[model samples]
Target: MKYFALLFALFFINFKQKTDKLIGRYSYLIEDNNSYIQKDKITFKDSVFVFDNKYMPKGKISYGNAILLENFINTSLVITIPKNQIEKDTIEFYMHDKNSSSANYLDEVTGKGRLIKIK
Candidate 1:
């Protein structure tokens, strides 16, 4: 029994480390009013797809081969980016809405930001 518990602990630790390798500290530059604004540091948790932001509740993020999607729990809406849409230094975000349309970040919650890898 003791051996089994030790094995389980080891497995869990390894699992966390592997997933944490993919997740770490990152920042998003929010585009607003013809200006690029910086949001803040967001810490991503592995396995569960959660991001930490002090201004709001926990945010859930989904990742694909090239794009990372985020959904807020309080409003509970899905935001995503298609894999093919990534450019040299910018990522586009599509708004979650009834109508299918490109999201405009001038005055909208779902805004696209040019992501720079800072980790």
Candidate 2:
């Protein structure tokens, strides 16, 4: 019974990581003093996310890894993206620095934005 429970836990964890992968491009509309209807982009591929701003000042490029958690995706920014965030044309995420030094988030860059993805 003990070994069965351990295996179940392991399987659940592995399944979460495998299914929580972030993929493709998600964009957020940036409302600035200047006129524009369209805006920035966040591209995710192989569990990595990159930011590319087409407008707005100080449009810098940054990237971060989408670390898989048991029930969420962590980006070292304290943002917990549930599996359901992929619905519709937006991926809502919260932002706050965790300042972790773990290997999981070692390559993540610092940035923030509420993205809207076109399906």
Candidate 3:
């Protein structure tokens, strides 16, 4: 029983370390009907994700916490913001590349986007 407990603890720690590789910065461009392009930035660090929009008020930022979930043996990260917080949507990022430098993300409301590691 002791051995089983120790093994489970190690596994959890290892899983966390693997998910930590997603920590980095990413940028994406949003095109509007007016033919204008808007750039957005998102950064993942520790267990928090920060999103910033260039046109937003100075010093304004959106914050969300991330949770790593396992589905049928595959792992994914989901970022969720409290309902009382900013109106921005939640995002789910699935790590694809082995290096964890890039991911495919789906915003809860705005569809999907490619998250390329910039840092």
Candidate 4:
């Protein structure tokens, strides 16, 4: 019984650690200005992040991208963009929700939309 309890606790801890790996890929929409509208996609693959900003129907229009860095502190994911990429668009990392199976990504540049995981 004692060993079974220990094993159960360890299993839960390991599961949480695995879930934390999805941190940066999750995002949502936050509009300080109600001037624009639309949705977007934020994805993680091959150690790179793709931010598709084809949501907004106006303005110059652009796409955002970023690279993921291993989190040094806490279980959160750390994200950064290259200088060239930053010159064209803005990007950032968002933390994942504990209760969510998947998370939504916020556009750090336009701050207009979110990237939801496809089922």
Candidate 5:
């Protein structure tokens, strides 16, 4: 059917667009009063993303589901970390450019930081 074909095509295009942009590694540096704290890394693949921070408990790795939301020409990423061994936080990164390799990381309690795509 023509309608069925159109629906499938639209779905495929949406899926491809979402996956293509976020399949890489991003790094952010944590600092306090101009002193180096630690570096955090986030690697995204498909619908899941893995987070690594040396300051976390036992230097553990945490994972969560990543959702990319687009508004007009701007895109933002939300990573939902469930209640786990490390911590529970819903981090939202606002893209600074259309390419999305650079973003501003926002935390409700700690304010904001910069995220740069390393890979």
Candidate 6:
């Protein structure tokens, strides 16, 4: 039992290191914003996801976790990005609405969101 426990502990540590490992700073952009903005920064450090828009009123910080899934990354209540959509410096969020695929995040006015990493 001791040997089994030790082996299992080691395996868990290794797996945790590999999973939830996206660390960097990314910024979200809305439509017509076309280009990247330094404000509204979203940072991911060791699986911790944080969003801070300097322009927003104080005490309005948005935070979550960098949940790395096999095919998607869920960082928001109703949004998730396909693993492949995450590029060298860009992360694209697509909306999956109900009545179509039992999905969420879709609407008439908005369909997708983009995040550009901060160098």
Candidates in order, TM-scores: namely 0.46, 0.40, 0.31, 0.31, 0.33, 0.45
Model 1 misplaced regions, further than 4 Å: 1-22, 47-52, 63-68, 73-77, 84-92, 97-110
lDDT tens readout by residue for model 4, 65-96: 53333322233333333324322223332333
Better of 1 and 3 by lDDT: 1
- Model 3's alpha-carbon lDDT is 0.41
* Cα misplacement distance, residue 52 of candidate 1 (Å): 5.4
Across residues 56-90, which tens digit of lDDT does each residue of candidate 1 receive?
56665655653444455546355555655432334
Candidate 2 vs candidate 3: which has greater lDDT?
2
Q: Give the TM-score comparing model 5 with the true structure, all chains together.
A: 0.33
Each model's number of backbone clashes? Answer: 0, 0, 0, 5, 0, 1
Of 5 and 6, the candidate ahead on lDDT is: 6
Model 5 agreement with the true structure over 18-105: per-residue lDDT tens digits: 2223445667544468553445776656444556753332222223343332232113333222223122122333222344344544
Off by over 4 Å in 5: 1-21, 34-38, 52-107
* Local accuracy of candidate 3 as per-residue lDDT tens digits, 7-108: 999999987752323355766433345342335676656544455754332222233354332221223333233323222232323322222434544333
lDDT per residue for candidate 6 within 22-87, as digits (tens), equals 567777664445653443676665534556754432222222342231212322324446555544
TM-score, candidate 2, is 0.40
Order candidates by TM-score, high to low: 1, 6, 2, 5, 3, 4
All candidates in order of lDDT, best leading: 1, 6, 2, 5, 3, 4
Which candidate do you rate higher for TM-score, 1 or 5?
1
Query: What RMSD does each model have against the real structure?
Result: 8.4, 11.4, 14.7, 15.2, 13.8, 8.5
Query: How big is the RMSD of model 3?
Result: 14.7
Stretches off by above 4 angstroms in model 2 are: 1-19, 29-39, 53-78, 99-113
> Considering only N, C-alpha and C atoms within 3 Å, which residue pairs clash in candidate 2?
none
The TM-score measured for candidate 1 stands at 0.46
- Candidate maximizing TM-score: 1
